[model samples]
Target chain A: MDTCIEKIRTICADLLAKGKVQKVIGFAEGSIPMASRPIAVTSKEDVAKLVFNATCGLNLANYVSDVLPKEGKIAVTAKGCDSRNLVTHMVENQVSRDQLYIIGVPCTGMVDKRKIAALFEDEITDFIEDGDTLTIVSPQKKEKVSKKDVLRHNCRVCTHRNPVVFDVMAAEPVEEQSLDQPFADVDHIAAMDPAARWAHFQELTKNCIRCYACRNACPLCYCPTCFVDESSPQWVGKGQDKTDINTFHFLRAFHCAGRCTDCGACVEACPMGINVRDFTRKLNKDALELFGWEAGLDMEKRPPLDVYSPDDPNDFIK
Target chain B: MNFITIDKKDWTTGIDKSRETYQVFGPVQDENGCQIKPLAPDVHPLMDAGVTVMSPKSVLFPQTQKMLTATLDASIEDHHVMKPVKKDDTPRVVLGIRPYDARAILLVKLNFDNPDYQDPYWCEAYAATTFVGLGVNHPGPCDFSTSTGCGPFSEEGLDVLMADLDDRYLAKILTEKGETWAGACGFDTRADAAESQSLFDILRKEAEKNITSVDTDQLSEKSILDLYEAPFWDDVAFSCINCGTCTFVCPTCWCFDIQDETKHKTAVRFRNWDTCMSPLFTHHASGHNPRGSKVQRVRQRFMHKLKYFVDKYDQGIMCVGCGRCVASCPVNIDIREVCTIMNNYESK
Candidate 1:
């Protein structure tokens, strides 16, 4: 991990010093334990702030669309999931291929901070990831745990461990694991009766304060004026009413029907800890089953919804 | 003022008794995390449920509320006339609310219950509620209430502040409202006021010592424009994704946006929780946004909490140091560090 971090820093410094890019968007040491913040560096001197670790869970491509300069290129540190989003961004014309310098890192997995916080009694003073083991230090004592135990739910089932696209590789590509059932969680929900499914979704989102963190965190949700904000013909009422709340989640997830990359940024960003990915994952399952398509796997291929096929499923259109 | 001792054995009975008269809300562990929720008929407040993921501010100022409604039918005589929504002013009691959170409500009151313009919904809900605060024996790592003119055991906004004493609770009934509610619950075992005060003092001091962090003393004296134009804001705003998580979980953030939604024949106006972090929060009708830049919006949040609110209200600051934002920020953009930078800034 240290070698990877060093390599990222060296690449960023070189890019900036030689004026290959105007800025390098990367992760820096976070204020809290087991967290890394997104940092923007324009100078070689400031390139040391860039870090690479298992804790870097946020999709750096979320910032790429907003930060990419009009003229000069900008370097970005991207994981496998982030690279997928960058590919999606290019396919959607959010950013140009010429304006990006992709520095891709192979991700093993990211540890869920919320889960880890609940496991520790005291504050985690320090954390070190070595191979498949994570050593956590607290005021009380040091404890070692398997990385598999703390890996985020999305990362646990991830099939993409290596970047789909990269101009520069930070480290050796990781072996991708094959999953027995990719949509096991979604299937479990689908198997439920309609009434039971409704009850489950209600209970899951009952505590949602409607903060919109999930929408803001996703790389795909980059609309200038979201449907919720549109007043002329308000799609969903901005209130805590059950119907309003349910509508907001349903529509937001529907908008990303075929575009969602399953990066888990939405779930990770929710303050209420709402597993909003379930709603999005169900859409992923539908796209795969109905259209035989997955998002962001290839830049040349358009999203399932973006392109219309004469043979496309139209059972519900009537 | 009198202090009442509530026995551990009769805690449930007392709470149950109060449930008959008041709408009781308290912290309960859900699938997401511990949250302050209105207790159902069967469920009771989890007294030992630690710091809730979301603050209890929603109890008085809901995340979304209906302010008024109107008839949209043109055939009616009084059609299109707006009418104030009738709000339920039923007596409510919030049990086991943290002292810092309770203090945060008071800070919010400075905005909602002010002389210039009173928010009827917030004021009515606030008046109908009784705040029973629970003192923190051990503060969280992010809590710095002591330095921000409040503490774990502070009684500024509480009617009754309860201290955990092993098997029992020492209820320091501070107001007549508290006494009436406690009396209804049969928690009237009187104890010496002076002795109870000393006990509270000891607990307060011990809890305060655990929280050692940034000080905001110099922030009150600092020039607002100078701090606003400071170079650190760009860096601070860098990692910020402009998400509403920090503002939503925050107990003191009281900004709200109002909109009217009309059905075929019924029109309803709702006020929902809004954050300055959103670009649309400041977007003008003509689409001209004065705070269009992310840096300006980010700077506005901190400046309003630390400088603007202090100068406007002559209050300490708009924060109660509950540290919900500190703990819940996705990127870990800590307020304590930002405060330290502003407080120590020499205007260079």
Candidate 2:
């Protein structure tokens, strides 16, 4: 652990001195009890402030495009999942590889905030991490839990523990993990009949308030002008009617079919606790089976729908 | 040596050159800042500083347009009264359109003119309008023309291309429509063939400099079909509120819902935008929705953008790479992240 920190610090200092990067986006120690928050460091003086522990789970890659500079280089710390986004951006031409300095972190897994919250009967005041085990100190109690029990779904079946593309490496790369257990919830839901599926959807969207939080948090929905705002032939109503709401949801799902990387940002941002990931996963599965496409995994591959070949399958087409 | 210069002050005279034959619409400042507005002779000054808050789409497709109206009362004789056709035929020019927007208009033409499915409304509007695409001396925050392969010299769907050359605007009339429009301008010195060719070269270079290419190399229709069960969807969809903001804001999200609206004796049919993010979007009349969950809906959104749209249309629907969805989404579910995740998810 000490070696890891030292290597990170050294990389930061060297990158700064070489004038390779104008900014370094990484996690900083959050105030008091909460985990880590995204921080942008510009100078070598702040290199000591960077830290990467089990608690450093927030996907910091989302900030790369947010704080991009017009000129010069930018460095960022990326985990396996975060590396996928960096690669996607490179493939999509949203970011240039020459301008980025990636510091890759080999992660075992990251804990889910909600799962951790549930483990504590009382409010958690502070938490400490010793490797994969987390020691939580709450107002009413303290508990030590295994990382696997509370690991995010994305980390459970992580196929890429090592960064696919990186400028610098911070730790020995970990082997890909395999899940022995079945996704019981997904299986149970998939077994249901069409009528039951409709009931499930009705219950889910009934709580939607039309607050576009999910769209904002997603890293792929980078269009400058979306379709809904067009008035010339006003495609969708701006009102909150049920039919109008349904139209928005269906089209959005269709739009993201092959492109969703399943980071779970949309579900986490939802205040209603709606399991939005289920729909995206189903479509992701379908996209792979039907077209063999996975969105952020490869930088050289064209998006599944960008090109069409006569030999392509048309089973779903009317 | 004589050097003739034309500035903003010369715009009025320039308008006067063809005022008798053409109507012009240009950018004007509104409460929401600059947008394209209807250019009347009286409101010509409004075009000087601001772009219209609304796009030129509104000029062609009005907000409250009546497709057809019907009467259902027994005493009134069950008959329908169709709305009178309103077409703008007097050749009109929309000035100062950024290259990206010109590309958008071009896309509209391609989609609406599908050989399989034709949109009469868009076709009628296209016939009545002649475009005057302006060069982007400065672009807006939402402009992604350079990244999406759209630019000033785009011949896909345009009539006249005008480039801002510091002192005087370089006008390249590509089509006969453009030449006729240019001839009506009555400029003393006609742009020679060499000058026009040079202008095209300059415009192409400018576009190339701004062009940012999205790597669609790994993306294919078959790839999307292969990863339907991948676990990546659950991880990426965690923050989605199931709001249709992404679809509603998307320029290429064309999914719509048709409804019948009634007010007393009149019944009108209306169509509005629909998104795949909402759970209700896939709900069938029989109460069965293929995309009943947030994960399924989120997956559909990406597939449509990266796969399905391209399947139906030969070309990718051409997302202008606008970042509105990144900023406008309330929970900040960035699409860029989702695409990255999709790119990384491995098949079992």
Candidate 3:
């Protein structure tokens, strides 16, 4: 991990010094333990602030659309998930391909801070990471736990561990996992009856406060004005009503049908700890089964849902 | 003031007896995390539940509160006219609320219960409730309440303060409201106030010593324009996703937006918790938004809490340093670090 960080810093610093890019967007040490914040460095001196770790859960692609200067180029330190979203951005015309540089860090996986936070009664004051071992430290006790046990749910089953697209490589690509059950979680929900599925969704969103953090964290949501905020013909209610909360989640998932990269940023950003990926991952499975399609894999073609075709499935239209 | 020594052995029986007189809300563990929910007939409180996922502000200010309701039927008398919905104001007790959160409630009161006009819902709920605060023996790394004019044992808004003593609970009754609830709970083993006060002092000092304070003294002295126009504003707000997570989880964030929803001949007007992080929070009906960009919106959140609140009432910043925003922010937009930047900034 330290070697990966060193490689990332060197690459980003060179980009800044050579005037190849005006800013480098990457992760930095957070104020708290087991947390890392996305940082933007503009000078070579500031590139030392950059870091790469398992705690960098947020997708750096979420910042590309807003943080990029109108004329100057900006570089992003991307993981496998982030690089895919950047491809989505290029396809959607959110950011031009030429003005962007990707510093691809082939990810092992990010750790789920929420999962680790729940294991202790007191605050996690500090921790030491050594290879596959993570030493969990609290004021009461310090215990060693395997990093594999704490890997984020999305990372555990990620098939795309190598960057699909990048301008510079930060490290050698790692081995990607080929899981026996790709969409097991979604299948569990699908196997349930209609009433049971509805109850499942209701339980998942019952704690939602309508914060919209999930929407803002996804790279696919680049609309000037989201449908939720449109008042002329209001689409959804802004309150905590069960119907309203479900509508917002279902609609947002439908909108991200063919574009979502299964990046897990929505799940990571959700303050309520909602695995909102359940809504979008179901669509990802359907896209694979129905159209033999995967999102952001090809830059030359539009998404299956983004285009109108004679061969497109009409069964769902009814 | 008086002290009540609640024996750990008889704690459950006392709380059960109090349930007859008051609707008790306490922290209970669930699938997601511990939540401050109403106690059911079968469920009991998890007194050791530390720093609930959401603050206890929802006790008084619900996330979505229906303020008024109306009917659009032409046959109805005074149709389209809004009327206050009758709500139950049952006597309630919030068990084990953190002292920092209690302090946050008082800070929020300055807005809802000010000189101009009092919010009926908030004031009424506040008047009907008794706050039983629980002092944190060890504050988390995120808590900086001591520097923000609040501490582990600060008793500004709570009626009673309870300190954990491993084997039992030592509760100090601070106000008349506390005594009433204590009596209802059958917690009558009186302890000496002097000894209890000294113990609380020792625990509070130990907890405060653990917290790393962030300075905001320079904010009150610095000109608002200079801080707003500082070069670091863009850099500070660079990674902000403009999500409402920071404000929604915050204990002191009290911005609300009211909207009317008419469905099937019934019109219900509600005031929902709104965040300055949203672009629409300041959007106008004319399609004009003053704080349209993310940078401007992010600036508004910090300036309001750190500068605007200070200038408005000559009080401290409108933050209790509970660290909910610091912990839950998806992008880690820490207010403590932002305060340090604002405090030491000089305009170019």
Candidate 4:
């Protein structure tokens, strides 16, 4: 982790000094334990602020679509999922290929802050990742646990540990995990009775406060006016009514249908600790099963929804 | 004030008795966490449940409420004429609410119950409900109620404050509303009022000591614009994603946006919770937005909570230090840090 951080800082400082990029977007240490904040450093002096660790979970690509360079290109430190988002952004014309300088990092996986918080009795001062073990340091004591035990659920099943595209590689790519059943969670829900399934979804969304953190944190949700915010037609009501809340989540997930990369930004950003990824992940599963298309893997091919084939399954349409 | 001791075993029986006169609300544990919800007929509230994930302010100010309703048909006698929505006037008791959250309802009341323009809906609901506060025996890590002009056992806005005393609960009835609730619950045991008061004082002091102090002495003297335009805002606002999580979870963030929805021949006007974090909050029909930048929106949230609210109401900052935002903010934007920065800000 230290070596990776040093390499990224050196490259960022060089880029800033050479004026290759106006800003270097990366992760910075946060005030809380096992959390890192997305930051944009413009000067070479501040390059040291950029650090890479198990806590760097936020997709830096979420900022790429918004941070249009005033002068040169903008450099971003992209993990596997984030790199996929960068490619999606390029394909969607949210940002031109020339406008970005991608520094890809090979991700092992990020530790879930919630999981760590549940374990520690005292305040966690630092999270030191050493190989397969994570050292949790607090005022009272320190404990070491297997890195896989604390990895985010999505990360544990992640297949793309290496960036799909990059201008420069920060480190050697790590080996990917082989999962026989990637959609075990989704299948669990699918296996339930229809009424039970309905009840499960209802229970899942009962706590939704309509904060829109899930929408805003999504890299693909870049509409200047979200459907929830539209007043002319008012596609959806802006209240916590059960129907209105359900409509908001359904449409929001449908919109990301074929375009979502399952980057986990929405899940990470949700304050209510809602498992919103379940909705999006289901969409991803359908996209892959129906069209044999995975988002951001092949830049040459358009999104499944964007392109239609005559042989496409229309049984559901009927 | 009067004191009564209800045995732990009789807690549910008392609440069951009160059901005849009032619908009960209390801290109920769900998969997500503890939240304030209406008690199911067979469910008993966990009186010792730690601080709820969300505040009980929703009891008075609902997340969404219908303010007025009107018919769209032109032929009707009173067509297109708006009438205030009638609400249930049955008294409700919100039990096990934390003392800080109870104080937050009063802070919000300053906005809804302004002398010049009072909101009848909010005022009426507030009048119909009784706040039964539970004093904190052990303050949460993020709770700084002591420094935010409230304390763990502060009885500023509660009708009754219940302190846990192991096998029983010492209920301090402070108002007629509280007396009514106690009477409805069949709380007949009388205790020495002086002894109970002394015990509460000791509990308050110990709980207050658990919370780390925050510097807020200079906020009253600090110039609003000077603190607003301070150079630290850019850094402070950098990591904020402008999501409504903090505002929605907040107990004192009372901003709302009103919209009229018309369908067929019926139109209803509803007020929903809105946050200053969104760009649409300041956007006008002319396509001009005063707070177009994320930094501006972020700055507005803190300024309103810590500065503008303080200056306007002559009350403390509009937060109860419940720590919901601290725990809820996905990016770890701690309000305590921001409060310190603003409180200590000085022109170079």
Best by DockQ: 3
Return the lDDT, model 1, position B58: 93
Q: Against the hidden reference, what TM-scores do the models get?
A: 0.95, 0.49, 0.98, 0.93
The most accurate candidate by lDDT is 3
**What DockQ was computed for model 3?**
0.83
Listed in order, the DockQ scores are 0.66, 0.06, 0.83, 0.55
- lDDT per residue (tens digit) for residues A1-318 in model 3: 547998998898899999999899999988788888888898999888998888888888989888778787999999998999999999988898888999989988888888888788798999777767888899998878888999998899888878899998999999889999999999999999999999999999888878899999898998999999988789999999898998999999999998888888998998888989989999999998888887877899889988988988757785
Chain B only, TM-score of each candidate:
0.98, 0.78, 0.98, 0.98
Q: Write model 3 residue lDDT over B15-108, tens digit each, in one string.
A: 8998898999899988777778888967778999878889988899998999999999989889999999997699999999999899899988
> Which residue pairs does candidate 4 place in steric collision?
none
**Better structure of 2 and 3 per lDDT:** 3
lDDT of each: 0.88, 0.63, 0.89, 0.86
Off by over 4 Å in 1: A1-3, A120-128, A137-143, A313-318, B73-77
What value does the lDDT take at residue B79 in candidate 4? 97
Give stretches of model 2 more than 4 Å off: A1-318, B1-8, B13-23, B45-55, B62-64, B78-92, B138-147, B183-188, B203-207, B227-231, B235-249, B322-348
Candidate 4 lDDT over A1-318, as tens digits, reads 546888999999999999899999998877656777888899999998888888777787878866786657999999999999888888888888789899989998888776786676545667777777889886567889998898888898789988999999999888988999998999999999999988888889999998999988888988888888877778888877899999998899999999888888887887666888889889889998988878888777888898768898756674
Per-prediction CA RMSD (Å): 2.0, 20.6, 1.3, 2.6
Model 1 vs. true fold: TM: 0.95
lDDT (Cα, tens digit) per residue for candidate 2, span A42-61: 79998888887765654656
lDDT of 3: 0.89
Q: Residue A25 deviation, candidate 3, in Å?
A: 1.1
Name the top TM-score candidate: 3
